[model samples]
Target: MTELLWYGLIINERTVVNMKKKYFLLALLLLVLVFSLTGCVPGDGANNEEHLAGFFWGIWHGWIAPISLIIGIFKDNIRIYEINNIGWWYDLGFYIAVISGFGGLSLSRRRKK
Candidate 1:
Protein backbone atom coordinates (compact mmCIF):
# COMPACT_ATOMS: atom_id res chain seq x y z
CA MET A 1 0.00 0.00 0.00
CA THR A 2 2.82 2.47 0.81
CA GLU A 3 4.59 1.68 -2.47
CA LEU A 4 1.39 2.32 -4.38
CA LEU A 5 0.94 5.66 -2.62
CA TRP A 6 4.46 6.75 -3.44
CA TYR A 7 3.98 5.82 -7.08
CA GLY A 8 0.72 7.78 -7.19
CA LEU A 9 2.37 10.87 -5.72
CA ILE A 10 5.20 10.68 -8.22
CA ILE A 11 2.75 10.33 -11.09
CA ASN A 12 0.74 13.27 -9.86
CA GLU A 13 3.83 15.45 -9.63
CA ARG A 14 4.82 14.54 -13.16
CA THR A 15 1.29 15.28 -14.38
CA VAL A 16 1.45 18.73 -12.81
CA VAL A 17 4.81 19.41 -14.39
CA ASN A 18 3.48 18.39 -17.78
CA MET A 19 0.46 20.64 -17.33
CA LYS A 20 2.70 23.60 -16.50
CA LYS A 21 4.78 23.00 -19.57
CA LYS A 22 1.65 22.85 -21.74
CA TYR A 23 0.39 26.14 -20.32
CA PHE A 24 3.74 27.79 -20.86
CA LEU A 25 3.81 26.65 -24.47
CA LEU A 26 0.24 27.82 -25.00
CA ALA A 27 1.08 31.27 -23.67
CA LEU A 28 4.15 31.51 -25.83
CA LEU A 29 2.15 30.53 -28.89
CA LEU A 30 -0.47 33.15 -28.11
CA LEU A 31 2.22 35.80 -27.77
CA VAL A 32 3.69 34.85 -31.13
CA LEU A 33 0.22 34.93 -32.73
CA VAL A 34 -0.44 38.38 -31.32
CA PHE A 35 2.88 39.75 -32.53
CA SER A 36 2.50 38.27 -36.00
CA LEU A 37 -1.08 39.46 -36.41
CA THR A 38 -0.29 43.00 -35.29
CA GLY A 39 1.63 43.65 -38.51
CA CYS A 40 -0.42 41.58 -40.93
CA VAL A 41 -3.78 42.51 -42.43
CA PRO A 42 -5.81 41.41 -45.41
CA GLY A 43 -6.18 44.31 -47.86
CA ASP A 44 -4.48 46.25 -50.56
CA GLY A 45 -1.92 48.93 -49.71
CA ALA A 46 -4.22 51.71 -50.93
CA ASN A 47 -6.78 50.94 -48.24
CA ASN A 48 -4.48 49.98 -45.42
CA GLU A 49 -2.87 53.13 -44.20
CA GLU A 50 -4.36 52.72 -40.74
CA HIS A 51 -3.10 49.18 -40.51
CA LEU A 52 0.31 50.24 -41.76
CA ALA A 53 0.54 52.93 -39.13
CA GLY A 54 -0.40 50.52 -36.41
CA PHE A 55 2.13 48.05 -37.74
CA PHE A 56 4.87 50.64 -37.76
CA TRP A 57 4.00 51.68 -34.24
CA GLY A 58 4.24 48.10 -33.14
CA ILE A 59 7.63 47.82 -34.81
CA TRP A 60 8.87 50.93 -33.10
CA HIS A 61 7.78 49.62 -29.75
CA GLY A 62 9.44 46.27 -30.25
CA TRP A 63 12.73 47.00 -32.01
CA ILE A 64 13.54 50.72 -31.69
CA ALA A 65 16.28 50.17 -34.25
CA PRO A 66 16.06 53.65 -35.73
CA ILE A 67 16.25 55.21 -32.31
CA SER A 68 19.26 53.04 -31.51
CA LEU A 69 20.97 54.06 -34.72
CA ILE A 70 20.35 57.71 -34.06
CA ILE A 71 21.71 57.43 -30.56
CA GLY A 72 24.72 55.53 -31.85
CA ILE A 73 25.57 58.29 -34.29
CA PHE A 74 25.02 60.98 -31.69
CA LYS A 75 27.36 59.25 -29.31
CA ASP A 76 29.96 58.73 -32.06
CA ASN A 77 29.50 54.96 -31.94
CA ILE A 78 29.00 54.41 -35.71
CA ARG A 79 28.76 56.48 -38.88
CA ILE A 80 26.70 54.57 -41.35
CA TYR A 81 24.26 57.28 -42.39
CA GLU A 82 24.76 61.01 -41.98
CA ILE A 83 21.25 61.90 -43.03
CA ASN A 84 18.80 59.15 -42.27
CA ASN A 85 15.26 59.35 -43.57
CA ILE A 86 12.76 58.42 -40.89
CA GLY A 87 10.29 56.68 -43.17
CA TRP A 88 12.79 54.47 -44.95
CA TRP A 89 14.73 53.61 -41.81
CA TYR A 90 11.54 52.88 -39.88
CA ASP A 91 10.32 50.51 -42.57
CA LEU A 92 13.63 48.67 -42.72
CA GLY A 93 13.77 48.41 -38.94
CA PHE A 94 10.24 47.03 -38.82
CA TYR A 95 11.11 44.32 -41.33
CA ILE A 96 14.25 43.41 -39.43
CA ALA A 97 12.36 43.23 -36.12
CA VAL A 98 9.67 40.92 -37.48
CA ILE A 99 12.10 38.58 -39.23
CA SER A 100 14.46 38.45 -36.27
CA GLY A 101 11.69 37.75 -33.80
CA PHE A 102 10.29 34.91 -35.89
CA GLY A 103 13.69 33.42 -36.58
CA GLY A 104 14.79 33.68 -32.97
CA LEU A 105 11.65 31.97 -31.75
CA SER A 106 12.06 29.19 -34.29
CA LEU A 107 15.69 28.63 -33.41
CA SER A 108 15.02 28.59 -29.66
CA ARG A 109 12.24 26.07 -30.03
CA ARG A 110 14.33 23.87 -32.28
CA ARG A 111 17.18 23.85 -29.78
CA LYS A 112 15.08 22.73 -26.82
CA LYS A 113 16.29 19.63 -25.03
Candidate 2:
Protein backbone atom coordinates (compact mmCIF):
# COMPACT_ATOMS: atom_id res chain seq x y z
CA MET A 1 0.00 0.00 0.00
CA THR A 2 2.82 2.45 0.87
CA GLU A 3 4.62 1.68 -2.41
CA LEU A 4 1.46 2.28 -4.38
CA LEU A 5 0.89 5.58 -2.55
CA TRP A 6 4.45 6.71 -3.33
CA TYR A 7 4.03 5.88 -7.01
CA GLY A 8 0.80 7.83 -7.16
CA LEU A 9 2.43 10.88 -5.60
CA ILE A 10 5.28 10.74 -8.06
CA ILE A 11 2.91 10.50 -10.99
CA ASN A 12 0.92 13.46 -9.72
CA GLU A 13 4.06 15.59 -9.45
CA ARG A 14 5.08 14.70 -12.97
CA THR A 15 1.65 15.46 -14.27
CA VAL A 16 1.73 18.89 -12.67
CA VAL A 17 5.08 19.68 -14.21
CA ASN A 18 3.87 18.56 -17.63
CA MET A 19 0.79 20.74 -17.34
CA LYS A 20 2.90 23.77 -16.47
CA LYS A 21 5.15 23.22 -19.44
CA LYS A 22 2.17 22.87 -21.77
CA TYR A 23 0.69 26.12 -20.46
CA PHE A 24 4.01 27.91 -20.95
CA LEU A 25 4.26 26.73 -24.54
CA LEU A 26 0.69 27.79 -25.26
CA ALA A 27 1.31 31.23 -23.81
CA LEU A 28 4.47 31.69 -25.85
CA LEU A 29 2.70 30.65 -29.05
CA LEU A 30 -0.17 33.05 -28.37
CA LEU A 31 2.29 35.86 -27.76
CA VAL A 32 4.10 35.25 -31.01
CA LEU A 33 0.82 35.09 -32.91
CA VAL A 34 -0.43 38.35 -31.43
CA PHE A 35 2.85 40.13 -32.10
CA SER A 36 3.13 38.89 -35.66
CA LEU A 37 -0.48 39.64 -36.55
CA THR A 38 -0.62 43.12 -35.04
CA GLY A 39 2.90 44.05 -36.14
CA CYS A 40 3.68 44.31 -32.43
CA VAL A 41 1.48 47.33 -31.75
CA PRO A 42 -2.11 48.50 -31.55
CA GLY A 43 -4.18 50.72 -33.81
CA ASP A 44 -3.05 50.51 -37.43
CA GLY A 45 -5.83 53.01 -38.11
CA ALA A 46 -8.18 51.50 -40.67
CA ASN A 47 -10.79 54.25 -40.94
CA ASN A 48 -9.02 57.48 -40.09
CA GLU A 49 -7.25 58.97 -43.13
CA GLU A 50 -5.30 61.93 -41.82
CA HIS A 51 -3.76 59.94 -38.98
CA LEU A 52 -3.51 56.73 -41.00
CA ALA A 53 -0.29 57.70 -42.68
CA GLY A 54 1.35 58.45 -39.38
CA PHE A 55 0.12 55.19 -37.88
CA PHE A 56 1.18 52.95 -40.74
CA TRP A 57 4.42 54.85 -41.20
CA GLY A 58 5.18 54.44 -37.53
CA ILE A 59 4.64 50.67 -37.77
CA TRP A 60 6.87 50.34 -40.83
CA HIS A 61 9.59 52.57 -39.41
CA GLY A 62 9.63 50.81 -36.09
CA TRP A 63 9.41 47.16 -37.20
CA ILE A 64 10.91 47.31 -40.68
CA ALA A 65 14.09 49.28 -39.94
CA PRO A 66 15.84 46.52 -38.03
CA ILE A 67 14.77 43.92 -40.56
CA SER A 68 15.94 46.18 -43.41
CA LEU A 69 19.24 46.86 -41.71
CA ILE A 70 19.90 43.14 -41.27
CA ILE A 71 19.05 42.48 -44.89
CA GLY A 72 21.20 45.38 -46.03
CA ILE A 73 24.16 44.00 -44.08
CA PHE A 74 23.72 40.62 -45.74
CA LYS A 75 23.33 42.15 -49.23
CA ASP A 76 26.34 44.49 -48.67
CA ASN A 77 25.17 46.95 -51.36
CA ILE A 78 22.02 48.45 -49.78
CA ARG A 79 22.34 51.90 -48.22
CA ILE A 80 21.35 52.57 -44.63
CA TYR A 81 19.73 55.86 -45.60
CA GLU A 82 17.17 54.02 -47.67
CA ILE A 83 15.87 52.34 -44.50
CA ASN A 84 16.30 55.33 -42.19
CA ASN A 85 13.33 57.45 -41.13
CA ILE A 86 12.04 59.69 -38.36
CA GLY A 87 9.71 58.47 -35.57
CA TRP A 88 11.49 55.11 -35.43
CA TRP A 89 12.02 55.40 -31.69
CA TYR A 90 8.28 55.39 -31.16
CA ASP A 91 7.98 52.09 -32.98
CA LEU A 92 10.92 50.67 -31.07
CA GLY A 93 9.16 51.45 -27.83
CA PHE A 94 6.00 49.74 -29.04
CA TYR A 95 7.90 46.61 -30.02
CA ILE A 96 9.71 46.51 -26.70
CA ALA A 97 6.44 46.84 -24.82
CA VAL A 98 4.83 44.01 -26.76
CA ILE A 99 7.77 41.68 -26.25
CA SER A 100 8.20 42.57 -22.62
CA GLY A 101 4.53 42.20 -21.80
CA PHE A 102 4.48 38.68 -23.19
CA GLY A 103 7.80 37.89 -21.56
CA GLY A 104 6.58 39.08 -18.21
CA LEU A 105 3.50 36.91 -18.39
CA SER A 106 5.60 33.88 -19.22
CA LEU A 107 7.92 34.58 -16.34
CA SER A 108 5.06 35.02 -13.91
CA ARG A 109 3.45 31.78 -14.99
CA ARG A 110 6.71 29.91 -14.59
CA ARG A 111 7.17 31.36 -11.14
CA LYS A 112 3.71 30.22 -10.14
CA LYS A 113 4.48 26.72 -11.23
Candidate 3:
Protein backbone atom coordinates (compact mmCIF):
# COMPACT_ATOMS: atom_id res chain seq x y z
CA MET A 1 0.00 0.00 0.00
CA THR A 2 0.97 3.70 0.00
CA GLU A 3 1.89 3.62 3.69
CA LEU A 4 4.20 0.62 3.21
CA LEU A 5 5.96 2.30 0.27
CA TRP A 6 6.52 5.48 2.32
CA TYR A 7 7.91 3.44 5.21
CA GLY A 8 10.31 1.64 2.88
CA LEU A 9 11.54 4.89 1.38
CA ILE A 10 12.13 6.35 4.84
CA ILE A 11 14.12 3.29 5.86
CA ASN A 12 16.19 3.46 2.69
CA GLU A 13 17.01 7.13 3.31
CA ARG A 14 18.04 6.36 6.88
CA THR A 15 20.28 3.55 5.68
CA VAL A 16 21.97 5.86 3.19
CA VAL A 17 22.56 8.49 5.86
CA ASN A 18 24.03 5.86 8.20
CA MET A 19 26.36 4.67 5.49
CA LYS A 20 27.61 8.23 4.90
CA LYS A 21 28.24 8.70 8.59
CA LYS A 22 30.19 5.45 8.77
CA TYR A 23 32.40 6.41 5.84
CA PHE A 24 33.06 9.84 7.30
CA LEU A 25 34.10 8.34 10.63
CA LEU A 26 36.35 5.85 8.88
CA ALA A 27 38.06 8.59 6.86
CA LEU A 28 38.53 10.70 9.99
CA LEU A 29 40.06 7.77 11.84
CA LEU A 30 42.48 7.11 8.98
CA LEU A 31 43.57 10.75 8.90
CA VAL A 32 44.22 10.75 12.63
CA LEU A 33 46.25 7.55 12.37
CA VAL A 34 48.38 8.90 9.53
CA PHE A 35 49.08 12.23 11.25
CA SER A 36 49.86 10.61 14.56
CA LEU A 37 52.47 8.32 13.05
CA THR A 38 54.38 10.83 10.90
CA GLY A 39 56.31 14.02 11.82
CA CYS A 40 59.76 15.70 11.69
CA VAL A 41 62.30 16.17 14.47
CA PRO A 42 65.85 17.50 14.67
CA GLY A 43 68.62 15.12 15.61
CA ASP A 44 72.16 15.59 16.96
CA GLY A 45 74.93 13.25 18.17
CA ALA A 46 78.22 11.47 17.39
CA ASN A 47 76.59 8.80 15.28
CA ASN A 48 78.58 9.99 12.24
CA GLU A 49 81.53 11.51 14.01
CA GLU A 50 84.01 9.95 11.62
CA HIS A 51 82.47 11.37 8.43
CA LEU A 52 80.33 14.47 8.76
CA ALA A 53 77.43 14.99 6.35
CA GLY A 54 78.06 17.67 3.71
CA PHE A 55 76.06 19.64 1.16
CA PHE A 56 75.33 16.62 -1.00
CA TRP A 57 74.01 14.70 2.00
CA GLY A 58 71.91 17.71 2.88
CA ILE A 59 70.38 17.70 -0.60
CA TRP A 60 69.70 14.00 -0.39
CA HIS A 61 68.16 14.40 3.03
CA GLY A 62 66.00 17.28 1.87
CA TRP A 63 64.81 15.28 -1.15
CA ILE A 64 63.81 12.38 1.06
CA ALA A 65 62.62 14.57 3.90
CA PRO A 66 59.12 13.17 4.08
CA ILE A 67 60.27 9.57 4.23
CA SER A 68 63.02 10.50 6.68
CA LEU A 69 60.49 12.24 8.89
CA ILE A 70 58.33 9.14 9.05
CA ILE A 71 61.29 6.86 9.66
CA GLY A 72 62.75 9.31 12.19
CA ILE A 73 59.53 9.15 14.16
CA PHE A 74 59.90 5.39 14.66
CA LYS A 75 63.69 5.07 14.68
CA ASP A 76 66.16 6.88 16.89
CA ASN A 77 68.94 6.62 14.32
CA ILE A 78 66.99 8.37 11.56
CA ARG A 79 66.76 12.17 11.48
CA ILE A 80 65.36 14.83 9.16
CA TYR A 81 68.50 16.99 9.30
CA GLU A 82 72.08 16.19 10.10
CA ILE A 83 73.65 18.03 13.02
CA ASN A 84 77.24 17.13 12.25
CA ASN A 85 77.34 18.95 8.96
CA ILE A 86 79.54 21.54 7.21
CA GLY A 87 77.34 24.31 8.62
CA TRP A 88 76.48 26.96 5.98
CA TRP A 89 76.80 24.85 2.85
CA TYR A 90 74.88 22.00 4.40
CA ASP A 91 72.19 24.34 5.65
CA LEU A 92 71.97 26.12 2.31
CA GLY A 93 71.57 22.90 0.38
CA PHE A 94 69.06 21.56 2.87
CA TYR A 95 66.97 24.72 2.68
CA ILE A 96 67.16 24.80 -1.10
CA ALA A 97 66.03 21.22 -1.48
CA VAL A 98 63.34 21.48 1.18
CA ILE A 99 61.93 24.60 -0.42
CA SER A 100 62.03 23.27 -3.97
CA GLY A 101 60.78 19.78 -3.16
CA PHE A 102 57.79 20.99 -1.21
CA GLY A 103 57.13 23.94 -3.50
CA GLY A 104 57.02 21.64 -6.52
CA LEU A 105 53.85 20.02 -5.19
CA SER A 106 51.96 23.28 -5.68
CA LEU A 107 52.82 23.38 -9.40
CA SER A 108 50.90 20.16 -10.07
CA ARG A 109 47.54 21.78 -9.31
CA ARG A 110 45.61 23.46 -12.16
CA ARG A 111 44.37 26.97 -11.46
CA LYS A 112 40.81 27.92 -12.42
CA LYS A 113 40.46 31.24 -14.12
Q: Which candidate is the best by TM-score?
A: 3
The segments of candidate 1 whose C-alpha lies over 4 angstroms from its true place after superposition are 1-11, 41-113
Give the per-residue lDDT of model 3 (tens digit) for 36-91. 53433235453266767778767767876787777777888778888878789989
Q: Give each model's whole-structure lDDT.
A: 0.49, 0.48, 0.72
lDDT of 2: 0.48
Q: By TM-score, how accurate is candidate 2?
A: 0.28
Of 1 and 2, the candidate ranking higher by lDDT = 1
Top model number, lDDT: 3
TM-score for candidate 3: 0.55
Tell me the tens digit of each residue's lDDT in model 2 across 2-112. Answer: 222554564466676788999999999999865664442223223243433343444443444444455556666432222222346545554564455556678776444
Backbone atom clashes (below 3 Å) for every candidate: 0, 0, 0
TM-score leaderboard ranking: 3, 1, 2
| Rank by lDDT (best first) | 3, 1, 2
Off by over 4 Å in 2: 1-11, 40-113
Question: RMSD (Cα, Å) of candidate 3?
Answer: 8.0
Better of 1 and 2 by TM-score: 1
Candidate 1 residue-wise lDDT at 20: 97
Per-residue lDDT of model 1, residues 1-113, tens digit only: 12225544644566767889999999999898665543322221322334344445435433544444454555553322222224565456567676676567787675547
